[model samples]
Target: MSSIGTGYDLGLFFSPDGRLFQAEYAYKAVENGSTCIGIKCQDGVILALEKIVISKLLKPRANPRIGSVGRHIGIATTGFIPDGKHIVKRARDEANSWRDNYGSAVPGPVMADRLGNYVQLFTCYSSVRPFGVMSFVAAYDDLGPHLYMIEPNGVYWGYNGISAGKGRQIARNELEKLDFSTLKMKDAVKEAARIIYATHDEEHNKEHEIEMTWVGEETNGIHTAVPDDLLQEAEAYARRTVEGGEDEDVPMNE
Candidate 1:
């Protein structure tokens, strides 16, 4: 007998039936958290998240939901901010080390691979529990834009559109309707907002309750500021979509 203490105390690797119960438990933590969305388009990638503040006092203290992991890579998460921060810091350190040694920005997929390995280690060790965060990593590499979803189990893959945290399926459904081949950055932004607004209820879908960022060929680093004009457009789109209007057409750039 492995002497399972509380049934939930069976370590991260295996449960009573050889199931990775701890990983599922971590995912449950994610399903109870805020929503984060990522959409990869021809131009680049966009990240949007709902800001769920514990209290009004911490509204300003909560900060933005996205972080820069490298010169061209950024990340967003939907659970355990501290865990996300720690993992991001580790990613930064890894990127910095790779740059110092190889004189290059770590490739987006390479960074994801390294982080996945790091997360996998925790799942195998009883001393530390798996991170309760599900993250989206956005990068503009030589191969163009890439989006990745990484879970507590260290599973990661490039994605066209993805959502993490509560109501993720709703968000993914919205993304599924998008044609990645023809999507532009602006259209992607509105879609990102729409995903969050749609996933969350009216109480949590207010404008101020949303935080968003994007990166692309024209935009460098993480973009936290959405122009007032653009934000209003996104809101209108979300509103119309909710009111059962037709989806907007993809913008064709010359």
Candidate 2:
């Protein structure tokens, strides 16, 4: 039976279709945000993002769409940036807690599952609004580099490569053409950057603004920004492809 609510606007009460209106709204928000890409490759994983700062006064952030959760685990996000941050912070906490308790880092799928639980708790009550965010997490472990996408409603999926946010369909379509089964670490990063440049609108399509990394053996992967020099190289390749320019060094792979 449909229960009566306080009759407020845009509340997250369950409807007959087994859907939460507020959660659907949050998904819509993600659909309209900047694009983020994550790919699981033979050697490791890579992430790429579109950078568009409205104010010229604001300095650029390398990983605006990405955040490190632990040594080996990282998350790429899109939608309301703050909500993404919140999810990132929680992922870090969970990772740290695992290390402290079991003396081991949490695996990628486990971390995603735990975070999904946290997100679902809020939906139990109408007082808290669902976060207007979605995350694509890249993690490495015994399974090697793993890619997973989680929605605001606690749904998660594993993928070889995935894209989210504004123009994501286009980006994903482009990404599907690449052979992730054979993609190496270096090439994966470059291809990710190309996808961002190829798909993002002119405003956010800035070269070298993307963040990337790979998972390695041992505990978790290092939670640091991908080196600037290599990132610059990838960005340059992307710029050439996006603008349809041809230089000896630029690869017109798009």
Among the numbered candidates, top TM-score falls to: 1
**Model 2 local distance difference test score:** 0.76
Model 1 local distance difference test score: 0.80
- What TM-score, computed on C-alpha atoms, does each candidate reach? 0.87, 0.86
What overall lDDT goes with each candidate model? 0.80, 0.76
RMSD of each: 3.2, 3.9
Displacement of the residue 241 alpha carbon in candidate 2, Å:
1.9
Any runs in candidate 2 off by more than 4 Å, and if so which?
1-9, 62-65, 203-208, 217-220, 247-254
Q: For candidate 1, write residues 179-241 as lDDT tens digits.
A: 999988888878887777788766644434667777886585443455556766786777678
Give lDDT: candidate 2, residue 220: 39
Number of clashing residue pairs, candidate 2: 3
